[model samples]
Target chain A: MSVTAPKGFKASGVAAGLKTSGNLDVALLLNDGPDATAAGVFTANRVKAAPVLWSQQVLKGRAVRAVVLNAGGANACTGPAGFQDTHRTAEHVAAKLGGMGPGQVAVCSTGLIGERLPMANLLSGVDSAVRKLERTGGDDAALAIMTTDTRPKTTVVEGDGWTVGGMAKGAGMLAPAMATMLCVITTDASAGGDALHEALTQACRVTFDRLDSDGCMSTNDTVLLLASGASGVEPTQEELTEAVTKACHDLAQQLLDDAEGHTKKITIEVVGAADEQDAVEVARSIARNNLVKCALFGNDPNWGRILAAVGTTSAQFESDELNVAINGVWVCRGGAAAEDRSKVDLSGENISIVVDLNAGKQTATVWTNDLSHAYVHENSAYSS
Target chain B: MSVTAPKGFKASGVAAGLKTSGNLDVALLLNDGPDATAAGVFTANRVKAAPVLWSQQVLKGRAVRAVVLNAGGANACTGPAGFQDTHRTAEHVAAKLGGMGPGQVAVCSTGLIGERLPMANLLSGVDSAVRKLERTGGDDAALAIMTTDTRPKTTVVEGDGWTVGGMAKGAGMLAPAMATMLCVITTDASAGGDALHEALTQACRVTFDRLDSDGCMSTNDTVLLLASGASGVEPTQEELTEAVTKACHDLAQQLLDDAEGHTKKITIEVVGAADEQDAVEVARSIARNNLVKCALFGNDPNWGRILAAVGTTSAQFESDELNVAINGVWVCRGGAAAEDRSKVDLSGENISIVVDLNAGKQTATVWTNDLSHAYVHENSAYSS
Candidate 1:
């Protein structure tokens, strides 16, 4: 099985005795002192986890030899003690690999927020993870990082003398520019750290930030990149851009597919807005509507709810400039509803709504799901 | 049942077949002028209903004689046709009463949005309602305006030379005060429409506007003030001020209690902020969090989720200056957390979170409820 997959990369995933189900929970990836460069992104949440804080500080130097991660408990709200656990884990991995210092390892943790990590279990887990590192280990590592995701998410985009392989973990609390996605990308491409960071940020702008389903931000969210220069080829900017976009697109879909209790991924397209931001806000406002989500779950054709949601936005458009189309059928025009609403079929798993502001040429698309009883059930009974 | 609840006011509630359920759905109130004065408010939604548009036009003049209301379908998004519906409903009641034109009769309707009024049923309802009008008819009228509301809402406050009585109808999509309240306030204090409109607007600033739970803005929200000059002694402005404040406080609670799927009313208090809006945005963000609501429903002491929500707002508080108190117990301070988390007891129904920004003296309070499966059930099942 490809664990640290992508050409010229080494990865490992181990049980670590952290999960009650004995599932794999700790993973490691090493770049092996390559000319390849690294880049990353982390949650905007102020309540950063111990691992997130530690990794962010290390990444400031922009050079890392390896990446280490664990799941099951987020080292958030754990104070100084949690920070120590993260440093020790990185140290253990570095000592075992013998090619870098603790500062050269980027660390990330995901899962239940505000919980303390079991240092006793993690200490041994890090050592075993380093010992088990191997090529094609990306599959196991992807599985190891998951919390509530129904399946593992892994993608690899091959380039000349380099490869960009990534994995992600997330489901609910998703919205645009990205939800609580904890992503890791590994490439043997020889690019500078600053350049890599810049590229990753650009890719995240549209791919990850546009998904907001539950509208909650997680404390343990993170994204990291590690490069091993074994590929012996420096790729052009164009090649890197194309590869990164493809990888981001793949990982985003993976996250969407695993959205908790979601049976359908509806795309809300807001067209003819004053600008792109207005379209985004209007679509997002509708996407975040609980009533509309519930209506969708029930498979009811409630177009009024859609208009009401759009109306609540503080955006530039009002009732006068609004025109609405659902599934390519115009239901409202010139500030009034279309006389022909019966032509639209809203009772389906896939629902599409287009709001034309008649103000600008820019448009925005937002992905969301209907509110379902299963969502309520999953969240309500989750802790118990 | 003591429906003409306000002193110096006369009201009547009667059967209106506009609703297919054969329930009473029309209400009338008469204020023969005031010894003191009257006031009014309206919804902030840009997509105003026919009645809202008409009532707003009338508000430009300020003096109101009577208010006529019915509940079956909200005449919103009906375009030119919708305005005609509001006109005919008022005209029917005015002709039967033999006192004024349609312009003098304020109108309100609440039920399903986007649907047109059943003219045949409405015309008959208006005739029967006029014949049944009486001074003691406030409670039935309260019941008539309810759509998803489980019960009618009515409150009364007595003033010198006039008695202020009020009735409101809204259970969903309520975050009133920038309007969004379908309310009828009656008094015999003898005031003109301009003064009344000013007071009504002022009172609503804190009362109706502060009660945002669902975040949805209704197209048909309106609040009408009728002055019946039965009271000979004119009350002072100070007296009206006190009455309006008290009315708002009580009604805000009523709206909170009536919020959808709310088994528990959670108050989020953000204190020590730089300003009121900053505190308000922080509290509002937390109140609007679906994950936080679900966690509350599960009785999970998820303060981390609470802080995460606060960080997302534009509030002027930093993580380091944050101090969190759940159910009156301080659990976090500075940039880390304390062991007092055990003090939070969400084991019961009501949950209260006190976040002391410790950064400023500003404060704001927001009310919300836990997300429950029953809420999903109710909204998903309802149509028209």
Candidate 2:
């Protein structure tokens, strides 16, 4: 029970024939609410998918009652016809839910871009999903939104009397701003649309925004949060933000662990920067360097490549004063070799690289995965 | 004859103990010139190598007699000791040349970083190279600078009476501002340091600066141009720029063809941009996209990935007005699927992708290589 872990929410998934494998590919999440309030975040890619455009318009109302998602055709770069398809999808969801307008329904799509959806099959699937909706169908909904992901990701955080829970699906095309994913979070706590939006923004900034798996942004990335007010618990903004952040963090970690063909989950911590933005820039540069990623994959403590990557950024730092540590061993100190690199073990699945700028007292962390043969194979052989 | 094709130049290559394989690892190029006017360009990365620092200082005087380049130890990130090593190498070269000072000798090094060079072996290798220098030794000089390069890159362009000849060595870690390579070009044309610098800068701006193989800038990229005035020909700046550009273009193409573990050489041309910088930014973004590289490697006409990369840039363009052609087939027109993707064949070693922003008249081109499993294997298996 991910999104359904909260009260007054029901969800279900059904096979839509959109996926050739005949897997469950359509998910419907409904808020049977005393109050229907929602907030959303989307991909920064300007060439957004049809569903993303539709959802952005729906979010303007901030009173969504349901969300419909699919994992087959991206419905991106398909021109006006694709936008109509997304509008039809939302209209179908709203009509099946009874007494709701199309503006109260959000739409999301994933998979190959520049393709149209099978409208007949998708509409029938939505009908099936709505009829089968149950309080405990969150797992099925989670499984339905997967494209390349190997497993369903879900997390729950308990409040005083309410609960926040979320589900996400992503395996490739992950990068900063947000991963190529579709996530829906639901809570029974009472909150206004502005508060929910604020909490979600704050939660996503430090959680999902720091993950740069493949350094590729997607055309259809969306995260949604809904409130039902069934628990009648009105937590303060701080409490709501804390619980939402916890749920987002848990889901983000799941995405990282399940990233496509990744052998290691690397966390880069950048410290001693002039400001947080500087630290973030430095960490992102290191995270995206293919040479550094390859060296880490080979378990080589190649501090030189790391330093070279750091030098590419405009972040404030003296080259000779930089320090880098791998697994608690300072392999590079003052821009030169300090400790024996052999002492740093990288055979484990989890790796930590710490870069100290020695500039000031601001810090940031970015997460990434190694570039492996499997990564190259999976990305090249398939068209995901 | 490469660099020696120009009059008043002699070069030699000698094997040193620095390379365990006993291959030629040191090269010496001496200008037997009546006039020694030179201009140079180094890596833009702030964390530069010891050789780059020394070479920059030498170039300040705008006069140089000889250049000593070695492969097998980059002499980078070794702190003050590395600087001392580079200084000592220059001084030794100057001493061997009789009346020249250390400031007239430029030094270049390539290979593994973050380590000290074998001073005794390197000095001995330098002495041997100086003694063996001959007018026809340019080919051997090119061979000595190989790190992962499979062949020597040399080119010569004939002017009215003078000539411009160059040799370059690089296999990986290629990116803009400049590639991770060292180059030396010699000319017999009569030109001052200011004119030589202007010509070199203009030529490189359109040639070597546009090749981005792996998106990794080096700490030791250097390009030097030396004028000897041996032919007694003073060509116009336009003529000099054209010949130098031709040599740089030929050498850059050779580097792209020999890039480490590459299967296909890709040229991305971005047209209809608001300005040249916008075009260049768009082209480089597409050139460095690993997903785009992988798709091309697998012979998949995945135009969506190319479009997605273009959307990441701030180049002025309406998403719906964008167009892309792969191998002369317009797969994406008006930002949507127009022609059949199957029409585009990617089975050859050379691939061309054209992106039309439909925004302005400016255009730019960038060259790159496809990301392959061999790239991962080579980079991960070795410490380079």
Best by lDDT: 2
For A206-262, candidate 1 gives per-residue lDDT tens digits of 677667777777776776766666676677777777777778778887787778888
| Model 2 TM-score (2 dp) | 0.99
Relative to the unseen true structure, what is the C-alpha lDDT of residue A6 in candidate 2, on a scale of 0 to 100?
96
| lDDT (Cα, tens digit) per residue for candidate 1, span B243-316 | 75666566667777887787778888889999988888888788888777887787776777777777677677
Residue A341 lDDT, candidate 1, scale 0-100: 66
- Those runs of model 2 whose alpha carbons end farther than 4 Å from true positions after fitting are A178-180, B178-180
Per-model TM-score versus the true fold: 0.94, 0.99
Q: Score the docking of each candidate (DockQ).
A: 0.58, 0.72
- Each candidate's iRMS in angstroms? 2.0, 1.4
Give the per-residue lDDT of model 2 (tens digit) for A160-216.
999998999988888846434789999999999999999999999898899988888
Q: Is the docking of candidate 1 incorrect, acceptable, medium or high quality?
A: medium
